[model samples]
Target chain A: MKSARPDSQGHFGPYGGIFVPETLMEPLRELTRVYKVAQKDPAFKKELDYYLREYVGRPSPLWFAQRMTAQLGGPKIYLKREDLNHTGAHKINNVVGQALLARRLGKTRLIAETGAGQHGVATATAAALFGMECTVYMGKVDMERQALNVFRMESLGAKVVAVTAGQQTLKEAINEAMRDWVSNLRNTHYVLGTAFGPHPYPMIVRDFQSVIGKEARKQILKAEGRLPAAVIACVGGGSNAIGIFSAFIKDEGVRLIGVEAGGLGIVPGKHAARFAGGKVGVLQGTKSYVLQDDDGQILLTHSVSAGLDYASVGPEHAMLHDTGRAEYTYIEDADAVAGFDQLAQWEGILPALESSHAIAWVVKNAGQFAKNDIVIINVSGRGDKDVQQIAEWKKGQSTK
Target chain B: MKKTRVDQKFAALKKQGKKGFIAYIGAGDPSLDDTVDIVLRLEEAGVDLVELGLPFSDPLADGRVNQDAAARALEAGATFDGVMNCVAKIRERSQIPLIFYAYLNTLYARGFEKAMNEAAAAGIDGFLILDMPREESGPYRKFISAASLNSIVLITPTTPEERMKQIVKDASGFVYCVSREGVTGVRDSIAEGARGLVGKIKGHTRLPVALGFGIGTPPQAAEAASFADAVVVGSAIVNKFHNNPHTPEGRADAAAFVAEMVKAVKAVNSPL
Candidate 1:
């Protein structure tokens, strides 16, 4: 079934569209055309599916959180184990698809932006497999926090360029990546890290990443003999959340909940809570719910995890919020820290801080659900890259 | 309704057999007071028109120079009210054509109707939103047309001829022809694509076609002026003010740079 989105001109209701310069318009149109052709070609589909299964290791286990579920004393919690994938994260799922698309487009090089470095590492891994030149743009500050992932990407034959612009974070890294993509459009393909940006990108990323939900739907039905009561995932640019949500969108029995980073608190400038604090505005390429000031200037966001430290979520998330099809909420840093610690102790699974935000929501709200109800949280990545930051955060908390 | 200064200036330039020069600078860079001084200096340097860039947080269409200029302006507390006030102050001194060059988001954030009334009151003659595609300019064009303000649309080298015909139909003051495919910046030579684009737009519209983006040096300006009705210089003048932004020296550098461009543009034996 065709998804209802991004009409002909690439607008998710009123949120998504091509707002880039004339330099990028033709390239975007070309990309859109290429993606459309690829969608209809079975050879393209067979290749993408083969990579998902053989290379990235598809259909990641839907492990029942037996200990955590019993301890919670209410709903049965199933963790969608995207952490078990190659590169220890679900990020490889989308990258593999985009890399194949890039190869078909005859692009010789790949460029991407990273905040937590999962996407960069994933893109670097795909580039190596495809024998394509790779460049990753990372914020200077993020490189300090995610140094290990930076090293990992470089070791995988990708040149990591440090961006020193505005706050030196995800948004700035994307700005630099965009500048590079515009300057080098002839031979380079920008492997956008998430389900954001302009037309075809958000739609394409969502389609590629939807493998998670398709597998989860089948796994849950076989294990529990029913659909999950609610499906929850952490939303930065909402790639993982939208990936899982799209497969279950038509199933009215399933509820989709997107958890944003609440950061420190719900104060004026402290949180990355877009629905609560943001307004509709244009940035980068797509127009979505953005955390901006009265004069349409973007505001900086705070989060414990670099991956979730963004000013806006995906346009589909905005559409979902507007349509009331999905519930958007936030879990603060302290709660996420507790979930990060408890999941390690209870399930022996060290979840990335980005994924821990989803765990935090389930941890806090599990008691409210019925005993017969089942919930699945997308554990998007393993916390291996976050070990140093987690240790530092623990030290900071103890010192206080 | 009063005749727009852009129209008046273009008519006079046609009679004198000279092309026009539109100078651009980010408002409130260093300070709003300095912006006023820069505009006055640019006018004094014989620039035919001016593009007052309202600072936006994420100007995706801009290159490094304008981006830094906006960051400086935003850092120094440049606001919508502040830009309008600067335009009002410039209006008090001269009747030079002024266009509000901004991103669509900044324009929408101020409430379209309210912003138009405020801009009209502040002596803004027109608008050019960098990120607004031709498809999304419907409501904005309506608002602009209602206010009798010119809504300048850009025609790029990549634009199809049929689309260019439709796009230029909404253009009131003039058609802005981007000299290159990339974002705004200073370049060594003009894009070979620009000359053909200017000629194409001319075949579609009776309105004056002003070419801009990368016309930095005098020779480039003169070269652009030869085929185009007017030449618009942004990053080159902005780079000068951005280098010194503090004293009379920065404004002096900007004025000097614009004076050379103006002279080069005037030297063109305008076929129009």
Candidate 2:
């Protein structure tokens, strides 16, 4: 059966439509047309496959978490090792696909917006490999916090523009990137880093990232001989989650769980959990559950992970939450930190703080599952970028 | 259709054989009182239309000037109802054609139909929603006409010729033709193809075309007015008064600058 989602107009049940300025409309339309053709071309598939295997180190292994499962005394747990991919995250999967699409479209330049800098570094690596000029717009605050990733981006020959507007965060960075795209649309391609934004983007990014789910589906069957009882992933803009969820959506028995950053608590301005505290509103070119005030002004969000500190979640997640097809919960910052420590000690894996939220959810709810039941947790990225911040957190905790 | 103040004002300008001058500023930039005072001053200075920007947290189509102005407005507690109240306060004295230049979410959040009714009641004549293109304007347009408010549409430099027809078909008030291929900000020169774009749009619709975006100075406004039926100056005018003290003298200082732009635009002998 054909999946009837994000219908032709790029809407996912009244969410995810084009809400950008008129100037960018034509360019978006053109990109949509180009991508439609590129998606079906065998040559395009062959090229992307070659790069995924040789360049990005694709088909990231699925490792069974023996130590964590034994310690938690619950379901058998497996980690989808997206953290081991080149550039140390799953972002390169989509970036490599889009960079190839940009080349096919005859575009010579690339631009992207990044929050935690994983996407920025991935995009920069693709641009360097493809020999195209690249620019990344990042918030000034994010630049300060993700300084190593910032340096990594710069070393790959991408110019990182520090946006100082509106809390100096991911939302403002997206606004600045939109401005830059509108100003220079002739030969530039905006490689939107998330499964967000208006039409074509949510679809395009999901299709490229489906590799994660596609691989995990095959690898899990070979190892466990059946579908996992549930799949868990961290929800930032919901890219990595969507990447893994796309393959399991048709599996009626597989439970999909997305963990949002609970930040300090569920209080106003204290968290980035949109489903818990947000309303239906549009922001940054898509209509979704946005953390906004009654006046529709986006509320400032807080999260220990820079990547998850966005006011809006991707539209597909909004649709999923509404349809009750997936389960969404939240983990507080302190709990996520504890989860991070648990993984590094038990599994010997330093999970990204964003992914630690997912691990934290399993830690709290593992007792609800049978011992023979299997679960998959997407290790979306490595924690090298977050080590410094965690050290600061530890120092502050000791002082307090 | 009931004639809005925007329609009447445009008719009066056409009868006078002169182009219109539109000034834009973020509503409640410093305070709601300052916005009311500044709007009346704009009318006195010969501004044919006042586009009060309903500030949004993320205004992607805007440049540094408008973005900062929005920040200041939100910082000063500029809520949606508060901005409409500022419009009502302006209506107490002046009858200048007032249109809200805002992004879509500001209206959609409060319920678009309710916001439209409130705006019409508060004397807003039309809307120039920066992000709501024709593809997404269906529901909003229905509410706009139901409330007797004009749905002002936008055509940009990047808008292809074939797409212009669909954009202007259900449009009212006037067509806002972007002067360049970028966000709203001041530029040293008017884009080369702006006049041609206006001429092309005229081929598709009977509506008056107002060239905006990047037309900051009086000379630039004059240059744009020479080809189009009206000129819109936003960032340059917003930059003038956004930093001034929230007082009558500051309002007058800003109005004086608008008076220069109005004179410049009105002096142009439109080729139309």
Candidate 3:
């Protein structure tokens, strides 16, 4: 069998490369070589598999939404319950894998940036489990909104520094984390939260998280006795979307749809819908489609969900978008709100505000497919944390 | 020929036997009108050179404080045209030496020739594109020098000998030797590497070498002045905006910050 190692430079068909600072070049090169070796090492795979089975509660269930199917009056809707994974999202899968890699590489500290606090919580959990010192940088705004997560990370013995610079959000948090890594490059490994950032990060994070698709493929085949007609996931930095799409990218029969947060609307400056309004530019150490001003200053993006408010999508998403291997769509705040309430009332599933974008897209387009066609939405995270926001929005809706 | 204000200011500093104090502030921060007020106040507070930071979102070399200030400037409708117009307005009132400090993308977006021409017309004296170093300075230096504006280069402690030689050869006005590897900020003391970096730059050129990044206190400024001709303080001065009361009291507070920083610099080497 051919080795599953990525190309020499870590490219997944011109999608990945080492776009990091000079300080990280050697470590990243070492990591690239070691990751290839580790993938084949039975010990490493066994350890990873053990964690997936026993720790992260892997083989997450595939639930068929009967009410959703009846409401759609078309395709049956099924969801891959990545939301049930340890740390409440698909992000932990990659974090756990990377943390193991960090230990193997002799790194003693972990640093990361979090938007909705999902990645930060996941990283903090992994670091605590691996007995490493963890430092997470979060935007001041996110720190305020995700106060519970801040306490959680601190309780886990990770230092949660509130970044007040730039837009006081995820992008700025990443900048501060990168600055920290650059200064402390000798002993630290930056656990990037998404399938973005410089070259090896996108590739490594994707490879580690590809277990989602691998598991989903087998589970879906076993559950449905065939491949689903469509696969859907929300795209923030496109991690979960890529995780689910990677296995199906080569499967020409499967249709991949990535949903972006449309915020209030797809107006030029209102939303974080990069696929709809962004142009090719560089931000957060990678060249990709970014929502920026004419001078290339990354703009302040808004979304109901903190995780989906990034101004740029992942570079792999950009390449896949350009190549037409995947289709991208948008879900406005109103649509996502409806989807959030609908998923809760109909399926007893409170999807993450980020993942709700995918749900919203599926709901809006449900009528287009035939009754026999099946759509598998990656329920990327649970929405228990967003209850307050949803309740406030509901009150406002009633008042209006 | 009309005497350029920068030359006049430099000559005065040279005569006074006092090292110049250069302060950087993001143009159009908070608001463009307020930035103009801040600039004028900084000039009045005995700042010799004012470096106007052109706000860019991804300022790779700036710390969080400066980066946030840049974002506020951009959000307040500060554009390239708006910044140049602010410079022109300040020129109409004062003759202080002004330098446009920015990332290369801003300069590239405005087109080098257009930026230089507009800058010269607005009484701007120098250019410090933070990310562009000596190797990539050819095209920018040609246009800036041709337009009679100085091209200032940054020298870090990690900069090697050959690169230092190139920087000094291409540099005009002064050489800004960053005290540390990271972005601009106020730190406790000058790095141990700064003195040696200053000595290396002095070996190459007679142009003034200003030590910047992390020079916060009078004692630190004094220590830096012992080696270089000028001390650059940015974050300490910008921090004033963060704490300012946004009233006349705020302006007073900002001036006080500048006065104290200047006093510290002057205490190192008094004008004889």
Query: Best by lDDT, which number?
Result: 2
> Model 1, chain B: what is the TM-score?
0.97
Candidate 1 Cα misplacement greater than 4 A, ranges: A1-3, B1-3
The numbered model that scores best in TM-score is 2
True contacts kept of 3: 0.15
lDDT string for model 1 (A1-400, tens) is: 2355678778888788887765677778888889999999999999998998898888899999988998888599999999999998888999998998899889989999999999999999999999999999999999999999999999999999998778888998998888888778879999998999988889999999999999999999999899999999999999999999998999877889999999998775688889988999888888899999998888988898999999988899999899888999999998998999889988999999999999999999997689879999999999989989988988999999
Across A1-400, the per-residue lDDT of candidate 3 in tens digits comes to: 1223345654444444444433344455566777778888999999998888899999788889899898888698999899899889998999988898888888999999999999999999999998999999999988877777888899999999998776678888888888887667567888998999766778888887788888888888888899888999999999999998888887778899999989988886689999899877546556578897777677778888889989998888888888788899899888998899899988999999999999989988987778999889999998876777777777888999
Candidate 2 deviant stretches above 4 angstroms:
A1-4, B244-247
DockQ winner between candidates 1 and 2 = 2
Chain A of candidate 2: what's the TM-score? 0.98
Please rank every candidate by DockQ, starting with the best. 2, 1, 3
Fnat of all models, as shown: 0.40, 0.89, 0.15
What are the Cα lDDT values of the candidates? 0.89, 0.91, 0.82
Question: Which residue pairs clash within candidate 1?
Answer: none
Better of 2 and 3 by lDDT: 2
List, residue by residue over A1-400, the lDDT tens digit for candidate 2: 2353688778988799998889989989988999889878999999999999998888899999999999999799999999999999999999999999899889999999999999999999999999999999999999998999999999999999999997888888889988999999989999999999988899899889999999999999999799999999999899999999999999978999999999999988899999999999988889999998888889999999999999999999998888888899999999999999999999889999999999999999998789999999999999989999899888888999
Model 3 alpha-carbon miss at residue A325, Å: 2.6
